[model samples]
Target: MGLIHLPTELILLILPPLSESDLAHLLRVHWSLYDIILPYLYRRHLQGSRDSTGNGRNEAKGFFRCIVTSNTAGVQRFLDFGADVNAVISAAEIRKANFRSTGFIPWHDTQTPLNIAASMGDDTLVSLLLNHGASVTGSRNHQDARRAVQPAAVDALLSNHESTLRLLLRRASPLSAPNMERGGLLNCAIARGNLPLLRMLVNEFGADLNATWQEGVYPLNRAVVSSGPEAAEIVRFMLDKGADAALANGGSSNSNGDEESTGGGSQRLLDQAIRHGTIDTLRLILGRGVVDPAIQPLDTGNNIFRTWIIERCTPETVHLLHEHGYFRALDSSQDDTLMIAVRARRGDILQLFINSGVVVDLNARLTRGGSTLLHAAVVRCKPVREAQAASSIRCTTMPSPVASSDVPTVRKIEPEYSREVLSRRCMSEKVEKCAPEEIVRCLVRGGADVNTKDARGISPLDLAEKGPEVVYRILVDSRCE
Candidate 1:
C-alpha cells in the first residue's frame, strides 16, 4: 500500500513524532491529509505549554500570527484544541523574536491573545477569543514587580481600533478594568487628537470629561497641548459637554497645593491656552470667563507674557492674548514683557509692543543680574555677535558687497520659533539670531541710558568690551545721549 493509503488513525499516531517543518510540508501534500493534519498540527503547536528553550513561546507566536493574518478558522481551531485564551506573552519575548505582522502590538506590553487581536483591529478574532473565555481584564507584567496590568482596551484605543474596542468594551466594563488605570483612555484619545474616538468614549462609554486622566492632568489640559486640526475641536467638544474650564490643569485640589485654596491655579488655564493652544482654543477657554485674562494672579510664579510665548507663539496667538489684555499688567520688574522680549532677541515682538503703545523703560534695570534693558540686549547677543564677527573676518579678503534689501534686517524679521513648540521646527533657526542689531538700536533710540550701571557696577558698554569688536562700536555710537 502507498503512503496515501495510510489509515487516519495511523496518520494521527505518526504525526505526534513529526517536526513542525515536516508537518507544515505534509499539510500541503493532499486534501485528505490536510483535514486530518490541520487539527493535530494546531493542537500540537498551540498546547500553551512551556519549556526552557521557549518552544511554547514560538507556538504562541504562530497562533498570534494566525490572528494577525485574520485566519479566523485557524484561531478558532487552536481555541477548540484547548489553547489558553489568556496566554500571557512577555513584551521582551516578542521583542527578542523580532515579531511584526504589518501592525505592532500597541503597548509593547505583556499581553493576552485578546490584547494582540484587539490591537490588530480585527473584531472577528476579538469576538472569537472573547467567546473562548478570554479574560477582558488586563494582563500583568510578571517581568516587573511594580508594573500594573496593561488593559487590553488601551491597546485598541491607542491603535484607534474602534470596532475592536467596541467588542472588547462589551465584554469588559471599561471603568472597572485597567482602561482608566493610569492615563485614562479619554485622555489618550485627546492626546492623539482623535475626536471621533473621544466622542465615542465619552458619549457611549461614559468616560468622564473632567476625570483625572493623568496623575496631574485633566482631559481639557491634555486637549490644549495636543496639536492637530482636531485639537481645538476636541477642546470645544469637551467644554460643551460640561468639562470644567476653571478646573486647574494641575487636577484636583491636592495637586495644586494652596492654589485651590486661593483660586490661583484656575488663572493658569488661560496662560497654558495662550502658550500652547491655537487662537481658536484660546478664544474657547477665554469665552468661558473661568479666569480673567486681564488680571495677573500674584501667586503664579512666572508671568505668561514674560515666558517664551513671544518666541514660541504665533502672531495671531500673541495678538489674541494682547486683545484680552495680557500685557496690561506689565510693571517695573525684571520679568516684565519688554525686558523678556529684549532678552529673547524677539525684534518682531518688540516692534509689536512698541507699535501697540507699550512703553519700553530702557534705563530701568530689568534682568536678574540687575542689568538694564540695553545690558540684557547686548549680553544676550554675544554669541551671535561673535559668530558674525568670525564670518566677517573669513570673508574680508573676498568682501562681496550685497544689496541692503537682500539682507534680513530687524524691520523684516518675522516672529517664529518657540521654546517648547508643538509644531515641527528646525533647531538651526533661533530667536536670538533674529535682528540682534535692531533689538539693541530700538532700545537705544528709546532713550536707553548709555551710562547706566547694573547692581554689579557693570555698564552695557563694559560688558560689550569683552565680546567681539562689533558690539563695542554699536554701543559707542548709541543714539542715547
Candidate 2:
C-alpha cells in the first residue's frame, strides 16, 4: 500500500522521521495526508518536540513558512493552535532552514514574521498577524535590532503594494511616528512614482509636505529626479499642494559637497534636473520661479554660468536657462563664462554666449594660472585618437548575409565599415592639430591676448606649435609671436 493509503496514526509516526521538505512534498500528494501532516508540523512546535537530532532547529520554520508562502489557512491554523504570532527569524536560523529566499526579507538581520508578510504584500497574512496581536510597531524582542512596522510599510511601498501599505497605515500611527517624521513612507512612494499612493498619503493621511524623505531629500526634490510618466505629474501635484520649492533640507548625508552646497532641496533639484532629468521636469521646476537659477552654489566655484557648462548641458537647455533670466544674473557674478566655454571645447556655446548680448572678457585669466580664452581654446583640443575612437563607436556594424543567395550585389553590399573608417579618418584629421580652428579664429578676432603666457609660461602660440598646423598658423598670423 502507498503511504497515502496508510493509517493516520502510522503516518503521524512516519512524519517525525521525515524532513520538512519531505512533509511538504507528501502534503501535496494527497489531501488526507496534507491534513495529517500540516497539523502535525504546527503541533510539534507547540508541543516543544525537538527533531531527532535533539535540537529545536525547526522551531519557528512552520510559522514563517505560512507567512512567506501566503498560506493563509496554514497561518490561521498555526496561530489558532496558540503559535507565537510575533515569532522572530534570525539570519542564522533562516540560513540553516530550507526556506525560499524571496530576497525581500532582510536575510542578514533578525525580522519578525510580520515583516516578511508585509514586505511580500500579503494583505491576508498581514491582517491575520495584526489581528492575532502582531505589533504593527514591530516587536523589540531583539532589542535595537528589531525590524517591524515602519520598515514593513516602507518595504510594501517599495514592492509597489498599494493595498498592503494602506492596510498597514490603518493599524500603525504612520504620520506621527518618529520613523515617519522624515517622510520615509511618502518618499518611498515618490521614489516609486506611485501617484495614487502619494495622493492617499497626503490627502487622507496628511503626511508632511516639506518633510525630508531622507537627509537632504525632500518630497519635491525626490519627485523631480524620479523617472516615468508619473514623475512629472507628481512634481506638479506637490507644488500645487504648497510644497516649498526653495526649502533646503539638512545637507546630504555623505561628503558630496555639491549636494551640501545646493542645500539638497530645490537648488539640487534644479541642478540635477538640468543635468539628467527630462525636459518636462526641468520646465516644471523653472515654471514655479521659486528656485533662483542665478544663485551659484558654493560647489560650482561660486560661478553661476559654470553650473550648466561644466555639467555639459545641451545648448537648448542653456537657451531655456537664458530665457528664464539665468544668464541675466551673470552680470553681477564674476564667472568667466567665455573661458569656461572655450575650455569645454563648446564653440557653439561660445557663439551663443556672444549672441545672447552677454559681455565676455576675452582676456580674462582663469585664476592666477594665467590661462586665457586663447590658451583654453588650443590646450583643450580633442585628441585625434579620441575623436577617431568616438567616431568608430558611433558607427554601427554591418549585418552578415544569411545565405549565398541572400548576399547583396556589389552596389548593395557597400560595407558600412568602409564608411565608418572614412568618417573616423575625417574626424581624426579635424581634431589632429588642436581645438577647432573656428574657436581659435573667434578668440583671435575677439582680441584675446594670444601672446599672454599661462602660469606654465606657455603662450597660445607655443601651445599650438604641436597641434593642427592650421591652429599654429592662425596664432602666427594673429601676430601672437
Candidate 3:
C-alpha cells in the first residue's frame, strides 16, 4: 500500500513512534512519503525522543554525535529543518534538566552546534555551520556563551585543527566572543599554546597581544605559564608585536582612572615564570631588557630572590636567575638568601648562590630569628640512620689519624652513642652510605659561621647536639671556634 494512501491521522500516529533509522528505511518504500516523513525524521533526530526502553533523544547529544561522526548530511538536514543554528541551553537550565546525571548532554552549557563541531576539529561541519549563519558567539543573553565558544575554538586549535580554528576566528566577534574567564581570545590562544592560532589572532585579526583580561592577567604571562612547545615562539611573536614584557600581570587601573601600581604584578610574573619552570620563557622575558630584575611586591614585601629562595626554587632555576644577575638586586640585609634556603632544606639552591660569584655573607643572621644559616640547618636536621652509616663508612675509608700537637679538649659528652652505636658503626663499615652531609659541607664551605648564635644565644653546635652524630662530627671537624 502506498504510504500516501494512508489516512493523515493514522500516518501521524504511526510516524511519531518510529525511530529515525526506521523512518529513513521507510523513505525507500514510497518516495511520496519523503515530504511527509522527512520533517518528522529531522525533528526526531534533532530534538531526540524517548522510546519503549526509556531511551530518549537529547538535542545537544544528537547534534554533537552528528559532528563527531562527520555526518554532514545529518547536520545539514537538521539545519534545513529550522533547527536554530545558534540554539543554546544556559548552564542553569542544563543543571535543572539533570542531563549530566542521565548522561544526556554531551556539550557544555551555552555551547552551540558550531562550538561542538569546532571542538571536534570537524572542519567540514564547521564550515557548513558557518555558511548557514551559525553564530560564532552563541546566545547573547547567555553570559557564558562567549566563554563557551572561545575554549571550543581553543580546543580545536589544540587538536591541531588549524583550518577549523581559522574558520571560527574569521567569524569570531572579538567584542563578544571571549574566554570563560573573560580573558580575550588571544589569551585563549596563549593558554592553549597554539602558536598558529596566536599568530593568526594577532597578525591577521589584530588581537591585542598584550591585552589584559580576567583579573588583569596579560596574554604574555599566560603564554609564559603554559607548557607549550612553541611557547618561546609565541612569546617572541607577542614581543615583536609590541607586547610589553615589563607590564606586570594584573595590571589593572584604579577606580580613580589612574594606572595602578605595576610593582607587585611584574614581580609576580617573574615568580610565576620561575615556579612554572619555563626557562625559555624566563630567558625571553629577560631578553626584552625592560623587566626590572629588582621588581618586588609592595603588598607582600617580597623581593624576587626571597620569593624564589623561599619557594624552594630548583637548582637549575636558581642558577638561571643567579646567572641573570638577580642576586645583586636582592637586599641581603633584610633576609639572607642562604637562611631562606636552609629553612626550606634546599641544599642545592644554597650551593648555587654560593658558587654564583656573589659575595654571600655566611654569617648574616636571619631577620626574623637572628639565626645564621648553620643554626637553621642544624636545628632542622633530623637523625636518620643513613647519617650514622655514612659517618662510619667515612671513618673506615680514611687513613688512621696522625698524632698532632693540637690536643683534643675534653668536653662533657652525652652517652647516647653506646653499645647500639658501636654495633651499627661496625655494620656500617661494610657498606657505603649517603646522608645530609652534602648539605653540611656546602654550608661549611660557604664559610657559614657555625658558632654564630640565634637570638637566644644558641649556637649551631649547640643545636647540632639534638641532631645526628654525623652532623655534629662534621661541625666539630670544621672547628667552630
Go through the candidates in order and give the C-alpha RMSD of each one to the true structure.
9.6, 11.9, 15.7
Residue 284 shift from truth in candidate 2, angstroms: 1.6
TM-score of candidate 2 versus the correct structure, residues matched by position = 0.65
The whole-model C-alpha lDDT of candidate 1 against the native structure comes to 0.66
Error of 3 at 293 (Å): 2.6
lDDT string for model 2 (366-477, tens) is 6668777788788765456666877888968799887656212111111123433333110122321224778888778766777888788889888887677777888888
The estimated TM-scores of all candidates read: 0.73, 0.65, 0.69
Clashes of each: 1, 3, 1
Q: State the lDDT of candidate 1 residue by residue for 127-231, as single tens digits.
A: 888888876766554333234555677778777888877777777636433444446677667766678988888888888876664455667777775445666
lDDT values of the candidates?
0.66, 0.65, 0.61
Top TM-score hit: 1
> Among all windows of ten consecutive residues in candidate 3, which has the lowest summed lDDT?
407-416
Alpha carbon lDDT at 10, candidate 3: 75
What is the Cα-based TM-score of model 3? 0.69
lDDT of 3 by residue, 97-148 (tens): 4434533333344556766577567788888988888766544454324334
Off by over 4 Å in 2: 1-38, 46-59, 90-110, 140-151, 180-183, 212-217, 225-229, 249-279, 293-301, 304-312, 329-333, 359-372, 379-466, 473-481
Better of 2 and 3 by TM-score: 3
- Ranked candidates (lDDT, high to low): 1, 2, 3
Instruction: Tell me the lDDT of model 1 at 450.
Output: 66
Of 2 and 3, which scores higher on lDDT? Answer: 2
